[model samples]
Target: MIDTHTHLYSEQFNEDLAEVVERAKSQGVEKFFLPAIDSETHEKMLQLEAAYPNEMFAMMGLHPCSVQPDTWEQELALVKSYLDKRSFCAIGEIGIDLYWDKTTLDIQVQAFEQQIDWAIERDIPIVIHTRESFPETFEVLKRKKHPKLRGILHCFSGTLEDAQTAIDLGFLLGIGGVVTFKNGKIDRFLNEIPLENIVLETDSPYLAPVPHRGKRNESAYTSLVLGKLVDIYQKDFREIEEITTQNALRVFGMK
Candidate 1:
């Protein structure tokens, strides 16, 4: 399994990072994609990736909530510099967020649009984070539509219509710990959204699955998310694993 989005470099794991990775590996989670929040977190992310090498991948982008009018330009510049200097699995964890603050909507849109350009120019996929701004996020994607514009809607928690829209736009949905919640809601209709269009993710150190809910999320709990998918798809565990792993490979252009 691939945890398509996680912040393992996050300070919360400072003491038990290796133990967490070992636990995750024990569960057959072979890949961990780390999403960048901003220039500040890049070094730690790189350090963590260096520690794991091929097992962990890094993505470059500014999280929407981090898109402040004062620092966005410099932050994006730093992101661009890194993209030109190295390779990343995706241009991601980037999009508009109104859940936290609506004042930065305009700037968030700007940051999101420009980063879309970065992804297209680099010929890489861009992972999206749409928080209470799906319509606005979809609008940007619609206008920026291009053959090269493709990515996963990370932490996707939208309606069937939203899911279909993402599919129509050639995007994969990043399913994470949210699906396991009693109120996660995505599970009720996920069976209708073909397994081929979905990818597994933990978004860990954030949304831990049931049995571990309300606690610090870790990659190992991806099994819980996997189990839920097994129930939803009514397919063999191994089959669903291969399908979602392949979905991730297709999106990230990884083997």
Candidate 2:
């Protein structure tokens, strides 16, 4: 299985990073896709990817919540510099987040559009992070619609209409531990959207699945998310695993 989004570089795992990865591997997780938060976390992310080159892949971008008015442009420049220097799986973890602070919405939109342009130019996917701003996110997507504008909506917890819109926009819904939550609602209409438009992710170091919810999430808990999908789709475990793994590989443009 593949954990499409996990912050294994997070300081929360500083002491037991190795054990976490091992435990995840033991659960049959073969690869982890690490999303960048900002300049501050980039090095740690890179270091983690370097430590496990074959298992961990890194993406480059500026996260919405990190878009401070003063440093956003400089941060974006730094992201561009990194992109110019090396290849990344995607340009991602980028989008608007009104949940934290609505004051920066304007700059957030600018940063989001800029990164979307970068992803299009690079002909790569862009893993989006939208929080309490799906309308705003979709607006940007609609305006910037391109043949190459494709990605996964990370931690998708939106409505059926939103899911259909994302699918219509050439994006996939990233299913994470939220589906296991009693009030996560997405599970109710998930079957309406084909499994082909879905991908599995842990969003780890956050949103751990049931029995482990409200605790530090890990890639191993991805299995729990998959188990939930099995119930939602009524498909066999191996089938859901194979399909979602393939979906993740497709998003990253991996073989």
- Each prediction's whole-model lDDT (CA): 0.93, 0.95
Per-residue lDDT of candidate 1, residues 170-202 (tens digit): 999999999998898999999999999999888
TM-score, every prediction: 0.99, 0.99
Q: Write down the lDDT that model 2 would get.
A: 0.95
Model 2 misses residue 88 by how many Å?
0.4
Pick out the ten consecutive residues of candidate 2 with the lowest summed lDDT: 246-255
Count clashes in each candidate, considering only residues at least 3 apart in sequence or on different chains: 0, 0
As for candidate 2, its clashing pairs are none
lDDT over C-alpha atoms for residue 251 of model 1: 90
Candidate 1, position 43, lDDT: 98
**Model number with the top lDDT:** 2
Give the lDDT of residue 69 in candidate 2.
90
Question: Which residue pairs collide in model 1, if any?
Answer: none
